[model samples]
Target: MPADGIIAHLRTLTHDEHVEVAGVGQGRRVFRVDGVEIDVIHRDLGRHHVGQCGSCALRDRCVEGFWALRVDHAGGVQPCLLRDDLRLGVSRLLGDPAGLASAVAEHVAAFTEGTL
Candidate 1:
């Protein structure tokens, strides 16, 4: 199933839902399930796309792309789809937990700044 379909099913199972489109742009949604709040980002690759790549000046304005690494069946790690030259083996990704965390933090910081 597509991500949006999965999200829709999850939303049905959840007890509550909310739409957040202010600081976070218009590409996020929140849900509460079993007393736990789950933040789900709806990738709006449609009209709200903010950039051509991750490092574009408008990177932070997008919430529909590159929220996590894509790993294939053979452990091919694709960090970004737009870059066209970024791919790491799963072993390499597993060997650098700190590096992954730092990268995630940097992206989060950028998103937060855009939201703010």
Candidate 2:
């Protein structure tokens, strides 16, 4: 899909989701879903930048910049995009809002079950 398509899809998926914006221009977007907190940290791909990142072509995925979504679970932080299953699942969710809610619920279950 095109960059715009992905952006639109993401907007649709997160439209009703609870979110908390943090930091300045390039900040973090914390999304709360089913008691699970997903922190999406924005990346500033500029002169000074550091962190593990995904290969999504849409350089500016969010308002700040490119983002990396990680789930805050009981055990530890689970990288949402780094894992193949999650990446694919998220892609699927972005494309279909009707299924997005259920998909998120499933993700929560998987996370709590230690399968994600």
Candidate 3:
């Protein structure tokens, strides 16, 4: 798969069940599963996103890869972006600690089972 493909997959992962960990222009942010820094931008803060900030100044530069999302375990919903380096880091972490992925999957499965 292409490099961008990896980031895209990571992005999808966030959209699916993970939480946000970092925001754009907020410097490097870390993830919970592993200590990887991912670049993050707001999804709603897209190019044509004329919501807040009295009109986005960096709208142009904030087009592609604009909004970043990651996971946050603060007991609430948080949006963050998983940068490329972070993504690669997580992929590595999962291999060594199969427990990491299993833990998450098991939790998800338990939740689905409604035994919570």
Candidate 4:
């Protein structure tokens, strides 16, 4: 399939399809996509001393719980989004780096456009 086609398929999946709001480390919604670990904040609340991804305006915040994942957008410049962590056991199912790159790009496009 074309890269965009794969992106379209991912866009159709709703929050209920792969995520559930949970209370963990100052409250977060955990997203489980069979492998990757992504914790999203359902509420606009902040985690004291824990740092906020959306609020921090610094470059190289890896030490602050931010990891770099390149995202290629079909439209605008790719935005940087923070992920919680990765599950080692399911990493194999997530696929290789090249495939993951495309997936991440598509994910960014779909997410920023509100298509997913």
lDDT of each: 0.55, 0.41, 0.35, 0.38
Deviation in Å, model 1, residue 1 alpha carbon: 8.4
lDDT of 4 by residue, 37-112 (tens): 5545333332322223333454244332322333333222223333322211223425576865565566544543
**lDDT by residue (tens digit), candidate 2, 4-114:** 444344556565443334322244444454556555543432211122222334324433422334543332223343343443235534667777657666655554344
| Clash pairs detected, candidate 1 | 23-115
Worst 10 residues of 2 by lDDT: 45-54
Once fitted onto the true fold, the runs of candidate 3 whose alpha carbons sit more than 4 angstroms away are 1-70, 73-96
Ranking by lDDT: 1, 2, 4, 3
Tens-digit per-residue lDDT, 59-107, candidate 1 = 5553455445566777555535544345544555566889766755554
TM-score rank, highest first? 1, 2, 4, 3
Segments in model 2 whose C-alpha atoms lie over 4 Å from true places: 1-86
Lowest summed lDDT over 10 consecutive residues: which window, candidate 4?
84-93
Q: Which stretches of candidate 4 lie over 4 Å from their true place?
A: 1-90, 93-95
TM-score of 2: 0.26
Model 2 steric clash pairs: none
* TM-score between candidate 4 and the true structure: 0.24
Best-fitting candidate, scored by lDDT: 1
What's the TM-score of every candidate structure?
A: 0.40, 0.26, 0.22, 0.24
